[model samples]
Target: MELSSFLLAVIEDLGADLDPPTRYTRYVNALVAALPGNACALLKMEGKALKPLAVHGLTPDSLGRRFELSEHPRLNAIVTYRGVTHFPNKSTLPDPYDGLLEGVHAGDLNVHDCMGCALHVNGKLWGAITLDSLRAGVFDARVERAMAMFARLGEAVVNVAGLSESAAAWRPDTLNVKDLGMLEAVQLARHDMIGDSDAMHTLKREIQTVSRSQLAVLVHGETGVGKELVAQALHAMSDRANLPLVVINCAALPDQLIESELFGHVKGAFSGADNNRQGKFEMANGGTLFLDEVGELSASAQAKLLRVLQSGQVQRVGSDREHQVDVRIVAASNRDLAAEVKAGRFRADLYHRLCVYPLHIPPLRERGDDVVLLAGYFLEQNRSRLGLRNLRLGRGCEAALKHYSWPGNVRELEHTLGRAALKARRDGLGAMVTVELEHLDLLSELPTQACAVINSVNNAARMSMPMGEVSYREAIDGFSKNLIQRVLVETQGNRAAAARQLGLDSGNFHRMLKRLELL
Candidate 1:
C-alpha cells in the first residue's frame, strides 16, 4: 500500500468507535505494519516519565513500568529531537524494553536498531511512537518521512477523539434539568447520594423518616465519609427546603470566635467587630443550620448552643437583646460525642440535644462493590472535566479498587480518580483513556493492614487452608486486629505514622486502635 493510503487507513482505525485499550492496540498494530520495523509501541509523556500506552511487540508488564526521561537518555533523545531519532544497533544507552520483548529470555539482552518520532498535538510534545528492527539501518530517509506523516496523523486522530468526547459529555439528554416539586426534589436528592449498598439504603430511610420531623439530627461518621452531603440531603427533603441552609465548620473557627460566629455580635462586641453581624443561627432562622465538626466547639459555645436548641432563642454577643430563631439543627462529628460527654470534654446537655436523631454513615470499606460504582461515577466526572470521550477502569483496576480499603472514603476516591485521569491525559492517552492498575497510584494510599490483608487473601487463595475455621466476620476482625498490631509495631508507637502507613486518616486510625484494644 502507498504511504498516504496506509496513513489514511491508520487514522480511520483510530477514529473507529472502540474502547481506549482496543483503540490503542489497533493504533500500535497499524504503526508496526506501516513502518519499517518489526515492533512498535505508543508511549504517553507523563511529567518527565514515558508510560507505555499500547505495544505490539513488548510483554504486557511493560505497560506497568514508567520510564523516566531523566533516567533513560535514549528515550529522552527520542522526545527531545524534532525528527526521527535513529539509535545505532551498538548504542551504549540501555533500551527501556531490553528484556521486555516477547520471546526474549530473562538473561538475554538483545540490541536492536531503533527509530522514534515524537508525536505532538497543538505544537506541544504529547507522546512518542517508536519502532524497533533487528536489521541495521532499516529507517532510511523514506522511512523517516513516512514515520513523521504517521505521527501527524496520530495527533489529528487524538484531537478528533477529544472533540467527540466533549460533544458527547454535554449531550442535552444527559444534562436536562427541569423544575422540581418537593417530592421530586427529595427523589433527586436520594439519587445524588451515589451508592446502592444496604448501608446507603438504610441511611436513605433514616433521612426520609427524619426529614419529615423537627428533631435535631447528629450525623456520625469517619472524616471524608460525606457527612455534609447527608446534611444537604436532609435539608433538601425537609419542609424547610425552600429556606437557606446555613453551614458552619466548628473546627475551622477559634474558641474565641465560635460564640460570635453562631450568634450575632454587637458593633463593639470584640476587637474586629466594626458592625452588628448576624450569626449562623439567625441566618438559618426557619431553616437548617449544619454544624460540621460540632465536637470541636468550646465549653462556653456548647452551653450557648444547648440553650438555643432548648428555647429556640439566640442571645447576641455584647447585647442585652435576645433573638428568637427557629432553626433546625443538623450537626456532624467524626468524634464520638457520647464518649466526649462521658469524658467531660463536651457538655452532656449539648450532646443529648444533638443526638436526638443520630444517623451513622457506613465507611467505604464496609460497602462492597459500591467502591467500583463510585469509581465509575468519579471517572465520568473527570472525563467530562478533561474533555475526553471515554474513561474506563481496566480489569485489574476494578479488582484493586474493590479489594483496597478506602481510608479517605468518597472524597479521597474522587480526588484519586481525578488525579489519575489527569495523569492519563498528560501521558497522551486522549479521548478514550483506560485507567490501568498503574494509573491508580494507590500504593501510598493503601493502609499497611489493608495491604497485608489483600496480599494474605491472594496468598491464601493459592494455598490450601486449615480445616479449622471461624465465622467470616470473626475471621476478618481477627485478621484486621493482627494487621493493625503489626503496623503499630512497625511505626514504633507513632500512631500518626501507623495511620499513614495503613492509609487511614489519623482519627479513623485512632478509632481502630481503640476498637482493637491496641490503644
Candidate 2:
C-alpha cells in the first residue's frame, strides 16, 4: 500500500472509539506494511527509556523490555536528532533488538541495517519508530524520507488516541449517577486504581502531582487496601515509568537479611554469601524502590535506610566501598508510623523522610457505589480466567456488597467474588453464570440477635438469670463461641462462609476467633 493510503487508514482507525492498545496495534501494523524492513517497532519515550508500545516481526518478550536511552547509543542518537538515523552494516553500536527478532538465534546479533525516526507531537518528543533489515543499504535516502513522513502521521494518530482516552475517563458534571458509573467502569478497566468516588479522585490527583517530583512518597492505608497498587500507579505516572520498579516486602524479610537485601553484600559477607550481589537499591538505580510494610523494619535497618536516603549511597555488608544510586523511594505501611516514631520503635528521621509526600488510600466500606464498580471489574476478570461466556451479579447482590462492612477491603472483595464465581460454575451454572445472593452465602450476615444481646448486656450491669454459676459476661462469651463453632461446622471450616453466616465481617470474625482461642 502507498504511504498516503496507509496513513489514511491509521487516521481512520484512530477516529474510532477503540481502546488504546487496539489503536496502537493497528497504527504500528500499518507502519510496518508501508515501510521497507523485515521488522519495525513503535516505542514511546518514558522517563529515561523508550518503552515498546507495539511491534512487528519481534518476539513477544520484547514487549516487556524497556530500552534505556543511556544504554542504547544508536537509539539515543535517533531521538536526539529528531530525524532519520541510519546505521551501516558494520556499525559498532549494539542493537537493542540483537536477539529479539523471530527465527534469530538466541545469541546472534546479525542485524545488517537499521533506520529510525523520532516521533514528535506538538513540539515535544513523544517516541520513536524504527525499521530493521537483514540486508545492508535497504534504508536509502528515499526510504528514509518516506519513513519520516509516516512517522509524522503516526504521531498525530497517537495524540488523538490519547485525547480520546482522556475524554472517556471523565464525564461532564451534568452526567447522572448511572451515566457516571458507566464511564467509571470503562476508566477502571484501563487503570490500575479502580474508583470514581470523591476520595478516589482526590487520591488519584495526589498521585499525579507527587509523581512529577523526586521526593519520597509514603502510602498509608489499612491492610488489604492495595498499598502496592498505589505505589505502582505512582511509579507508572512518574517520569521514571520505563525504568525498573523494584519491590521489597519488609514484613516478609528476615531481620538478618534485611540489610543485605536493601544494601547488597560482598562475597563472604556472611555464611552462604558466595558472590557479591546488588541489592534492591542498586537494582532500582534510576528507577523506583517500593518498600512495602515499611513499619516492620528493625531499628538498625531503619538507621541504615535513613543513611541511604540522606546520602544516596549504599554500602555493601562487610565492605567499605559505597556505591552511589539514583533511586526514588516509595514506602507503604498499614501501621501509623508517626505513633511508632513517638513510641521510639521507628526512627523519627526515616519517618519524616518518607512522609515528605503522604497519600492515604480510603477503605472499601467508605467508597459507597465503588464496591459495585469493583465487583464488575473482578467479575469480568473471573469470566476471562474461567473461560465462561458470561458472568454477572444477580438481583440484590450489589446491594448486599455495598451494605456489608468490608473490613478486609478491596482484597477481601476480590477473593469473595472469585470464590463465588467458581462455586456458581461448579454448581452447574454453565456459560451464563449469574452470582446470586445464595452463591455469596451472605444471608447469614444479616443483622441477627447478636447485636441485641450485646445491647442488653451493655444496658444491664448483671443479668438476673445466670447460667451455671458463670458471670453474665462469661456466659455471653461462651454463647458467642458456641454459635461461631456451630457455624464453622456447618460451613465445613470455611471461615469466610462462617463469618458471613454469623453476621460479621471476616476481619472481625477472625478477631473473635482469636479472642475465643479458637483460631
Candidate 3:
C-alpha cells in the first residue's frame, strides 16, 4: 500500500457521513495499508493511560486493555518522544501486546520490530499511534519516514472526528499528578461500561445527555449488569462531581431500621441510638445520593423517602425540627420496578418519582464482542495479581466467551476469567499464560446429568397439573418451582451451589424460592 493510496482512501472516508467510531476505524485501516507492520493501533491518552480506540491485526480483546505509562516502558517512550522512535530488535523493553497479536504467540515476539510516534492536534499532545511487526528489520528508514507522514494523517483524522457530538463529549485532557489518581478511579468505574456496540453507544449518549440535568435517574438492568457503575458514571460526569457521592444499599438495611438510616436518629431515639447521628440525606446535602436496590425499600420507608423528596427536607426520628438539604437522587434496581408496582410490592408514586430519566443497560448477551474486550480487562488485573508476565486467551477461548449467554453479565465474566487465570497459572504455562477453553467455568451449559434431572422434573410438573387448561405463566411457574426444588435437593440445601448449578444469581434464586413458597 502506497502513501498516495492511503491519503486517497482517508479522503474518501472523510467525505462520507459516518459515525465517529466507524470513521476512526476506517482511519486505522488506512494506516495499516500505508504502514510496514502486521499490527497497528491508534491509542488515545487518558490521564496516565493509553486506550486503544482502533486497531488492525490485533485481537479484539486488545481494545479492552489499558496500557499505563508506569507499566509499559515501550508506550511511555513512544508518548514522551517527539520524533518516531523505532526500537531495536534487542530492545530490553517488553511489548505490551505480548500474546495479544492476532494469530501470533507471545514466544514469536521476542525480536519483533516496533515503532511509534506521539500525535498532536491543535498544538496539544493528543495520543500516539504504534506499529509492530513479528519480524526484525521491518521498520527501516523508509518505513520510519512513512510512519511520520501517516502520524500527521492520523492527527487530521482525529481533528475531523472530533467535530462529532460523541467524540467531542469525551475528549480527554492531560491531567496533573493531583488529578491523575482521581481520574484513574473514575476510569475504572467507566471501564466496565466500555463497548462499541449500538446498545452501549446509545447508553453512553443517554448518560452524557442526562448527567448535566438535575432530574432523578433510575438505572435498570439485570443482576451483574453494572447498574452501580452506571450510577457512578452519572454522578462523576454531573455538575456534582466534586461533591460527595453517598451510597445507601436499600436491600442491606433491615425493615425496622430503614427509617432511622435514611432520616437519621437523635440520642435515645431507638434501641441502638445512643449518639447524635447524620443520615444519608444530610450527608449528601449538596451532592448525589445513590440508592442501590431501590425496589427493596419497605412500604413505610417509601413514604418517608417520598416526603423528603417532595419537600427537600428531613426530620430526625426523635426531634421535630426539620433540616433542609439539597440532594440529587440516582436510584438503581435489578428488579423490574414497573412489574413490582403492578404487583403492589412497590409504591407506584415513588416509582414515578425515581424514574424521571430511565436508563436501561443492555445485558451481556446482547453485547457481541464486548465480552472479549471485558475479558481482556479482567485478564490484565489477574496477570498483575498472579505475577505473570502476560495473560491471554488461547485458541477457541474467545469464541467460547462470545457465543455463550452470560446470564450473570459482566460480574460473572470477571469471576470466570479470574478462576481461569489461576487454573492456567497452576498449570505452569511459564510467564506467558494462555487461558484455554476448558479452564472456563461456564455454567450456562449444564452437564448431562443436570439436564436429565431438569427434563424429568419439567415433565413431572406438566403431568401433575389439573386437567383444566392453565395459563402459560402458571405452567412456567410450576416448572420453575420443580426445577428449583430438584437442584436444592441435589445440592443438599446449599443455596449458593444450587444457584450456580442452575445458572442464577444467589439473590435471584432466593427471591424465586420465596415467590414459589419453597423457602
- Candidate number with greatest lDDT: 3
Minimal lDDT window, size 10, model 1: 174-183
Best by TM-score: 3
Expressed as tens digits, the lDDT of each residue in 275-375 for candidate 1 is 99999999999999999999998888788788888888888899999999988899999999999989999998888888999999988876655675577
Task: Kindly state the number of residue pairs that clash in model 1.
Answer: 4
lDDT by residue (1-519, candidate 2, tens digit) is 677898789768866888666788788888778867767888887666676778887654455345668767888998998778999888988677654564443223454798898988889898999888877777788888888888887788788866775676564422233333333333332423565466676776676667759999999999988888878777777788789999999999888998899999999999999999999999999999999999999888888889999999999998999999999999999999999989999999899999999999988876645676677667656766787655556544654775567778988888898999998788743335667677876656645454444444333314423323543334446766777788899999999888666555465567669969998
Model 3, 39: alpha-carbon shift in Å? 0.5
How much does candidate 3 score in TM-score? 0.79
Q: Point out the worst 10-residue segment of candidate 2 by lDDT.
A: 173-182
Q: Write the per-residue lDDT of candidate 3 for residues 1-519, one digit (tens) a residue.
A: 568888788878766778666788888888887776888899988777888889888887989988778888899999998899999789988788888887565567777889999998899888999999888998899889878888887888887776563444454432222233333466664567766565676777677778769999999999999888888878887789989899999999998888788989899988878999999999998999999999988898898899898899998889989999989999999999999999999989999999999999999877756787898888878887887778888755664675567789999999889999999998855568889767885524755554454445445435544443653235546767877787889999999898767655455567668868998
TM-scores, one per candidate: 0.52, 0.53, 0.79
